[model samples]
Target: MTTQMIIRLDSETKTKLTKLAQAEGKNTSQVVRELIEDYIQNRDMGSYIDDLWDRLGKKLKARNVGSREIERAIYESRASKK
Candidate 1:
């Protein structure tokens, strides 16, 4: 069940969208739908970052690497650049 949406775009934006659609062999509506879906998926990036950090912590723990060691290595690396 899909609802029809009416949007207003300026001529230049509409033209660019139409060209992009044609280049991708899609209609403007399909391209717009895909772009909207991508935007929706990435909107909750905080949760994504938290999950990423959790996974990284588990991996580091398995390798016996503590956060203090990681911070020291980062500090050393930054100091070497100066």
Candidate 2:
């Protein structure tokens, strides 16, 4: 099912959107729809951070780095700052 929406944009923003739509060979509606979809699909910060940490952990484990080593480094840095 399709629904119609009405949006109002300032003149500059409307001009920019029009140019972008023309450059991409899409109608303004298609560009606006894609932008709205992207805005809706973006990840929340906690999930984004968890994903980053998971990737970092995998890379660190591949290089044989352990949590204790990381903890000791953190402690040493904190101690030096004291």
Candidate that scores best on TM-score: 1
TM-score of each candidate structure, all chains considered together:
0.52, 0.49
lDDT of 2 by residue, 1-82 (tens): 9899999999999999899899989989999899887775574677678888999899989999998998998899999999
State how far residue 76 of model 1 sits from its true place (Å): 31
As a whole number from 0 to 100, the lDDT of residue 66 in candidate 1 is 85
lDDT of each: 0.93, 0.89
Deviating ranges (above 4 Å) for candidate 2: 43-82
Candidate 1 TM-score, C-alpha based: 0.52
- Model 1 lDDT per residue over 1-82, tens place: 9999999999999999999899999999999899888887688788679889999889999999988999999999999999
CA shift of 47, model 1, Å: 8.8
**Which residue window of length 10 is worst by lDDT in model 2?**
39-48
Report residue 55 deviation for candidate 1 (angstroms): 10
